[model samples]
Target: MGIAEERITRLHQLAHEATASGDFDLAREYVRLARRVAERNRCGLPKSFRRFICDECDAYLRPGVNARFRTQSGGHVVVRCDCGATKRYPY
Candidate 1:
């Protein structure tokens, strides 16, 4: 796999471990790291999947598209595209 993919996988593993160990903070941190790697790699959610990516920006579309709350877990995560555009979808 590519470096970004590897990093994302590692981060997921770390998050899982942290969650199992009751380390919500650590898990959240790992999630953040994964997001960063995904953003850097310009990886976006596939249209066939439950997510959508912005054509202008390769951000990962997540859930909570129009929620008032500001929680990161269920919200759409996206990366800024070259044209400074972003997309969102249900996580």
Candidate 2:
């Protein structure tokens, strides 16, 4: 992995840790920083990282904590962030 990718991965871990510790603002900062790094490096964010972040509010989702996860009958998974942004992914 390149330096940018490594930094993003580290930031992802840090964000997860911050969220677990109940410091959501710090987690959001980490998420935004990681995204900026990826943009500057012209690299796509990791799939796991992309799925866990809200596109509208830039919040790191923690499933039931700040996001709701559901499976629809249409063969897709729906993730709704606390900010009311919803994302759908095929299963």
Candidate 3:
């Protein structure tokens, strides 16, 4: 993998390890670093350019309720489904 990809992977690993160890403070720091690296590498597309996919219906998420971003370990999005299921998309 390229340097950016390797860095991103390391960031995720660190964040995961921190969380698994119950070191929330360290996890947050790792998450912050991951976000910065992702932003710097232009890995995540802009909101307007992003294509939301519903994990349940396999359809495009309609907008508002389907969108939520978290600066967690690795990137994650919480999507509220019409079926009353809350699905998390992680990358």
Candidate 4:
């Protein structure tokens, strides 16, 4: 993988660790930095990275921690961030 992609992945790992340790601010910073790197390198954020970040608040999500996950009858999964931003994706 390219340097930018590798860096983004590393940042993703750091964010996950930070969140797990309850350092949410650090995780948010990591997410922001990853996005900046992706933008500068003209590379799209990885799919998993995009899905795990809150588009409205820029927070790294950890399922039940600061976000909620639910399945709907509409045949899609919903992710609601603590900031109340909702995202839906097909299963």
Candidate 5:
């Protein structure tokens, strides 16, 4: 990983820690900053990091708190956010 990727990884870790501590708002801010860093540096968030955030509400999903994970038919994975937004990924 290069410098930008390293920075992005660090930011994602911070967001995870913030969410774990029940400071969701802080986590959201961290995600926003991470995105900006990625954009400025011409990179994207790692695939694993992308799945932890709700695209609609920018919420950090804790897998049963603010988000629900379901396995759909045909090898699809569904993530439903508390904001009523759903994302389906074919895994």
Candidate 6:
């Protein structure tokens, strides 16, 4: 893979590790940096990372902690971030 792609992946990995270690703040910052790298390279964020990145505050979401997930009727899944952003995804 290219250097930019590798950097992006590394940042995402660090973000995941930070979240796993109960450091939500670092995880959020890592994700934000990863997004910047991706944008500078004109690339898209990974699918796995996309779900965890809050669209409103750009915070990294840890399910049940910083984010609340709800599966509603009518083929909708909602993710509510601590920043009061509600995102709906069609399942």
Q: Model 4, which residues run further than 4 Å from truth?
A: none
**lDDT by residue (tens digit), candidate 3, 8-67:** 677666655665666756755765665577689888522321234333443334434334
- Per-residue CA lDDT of candidate 6, range 1-91, in tens? 8888899889888987888888988988988899889889999888877988898787888888789999988889899999999988888
Superposed on all Cα atoms, the candidates' RMSDs to the truth, in angstroms, are 9.9, 0.6, 12.1, 0.6, 1.0, 1.3
TM-scores of the candidates in the order shown: 0.49, 0.98, 0.49, 0.97, 0.93, 0.88
> Which residue ranges in model 5 land beyond 4 Å of their true spot?
none
- lDDT by residue for model 4 over 1-91, one digit each (tens)? 9999999999999999999999999999999999999999999999999999999889999888999999999899999999999999998
What's the CA error at residue 47 for candidate 5, in Å? 0.4
Clashes of each: 9, 0, 0, 0, 0, 0
**Higher-ranked by TM-score: 1 or 4:** 4
Q: What is the lDDT of residue 74 in candidate 6?
A: 88
For model 1, residues 1-91, the per-residue Cα lDDT tens digits are: 6877777766666665665666756655666666677777898422342132334332233323311223257675444333445444455
TM-score of 6: 0.88
Highest TM-score against the true fold, candidate: 2
- Model 5's C-alpha root-mean-square deviation from the true structure amounts to 1.0
Give, for candidate 5, the lowest lDDT window spanning 10 residues: 57-66
Candidate 2 lDDT, 30-82, residue by residue in tens: 99999999999999999999999999988999988999999999999999999
- Please give the distance, in angstroms, between residue 67's alpha carbon in candidate 6 and its true position after superposition: 0.6
Number of backbone clashes in candidate 2: 0
lDDT of 1 at 37: 71
Model 4: clashing residue pairs? none
Ranking of predictions according to lDDT: 2, 4, 5, 6, 3, 1
User: Considering TM-score, which of the candidate structures 2 and 6 is the better prediction for this target?
Assistant: 2
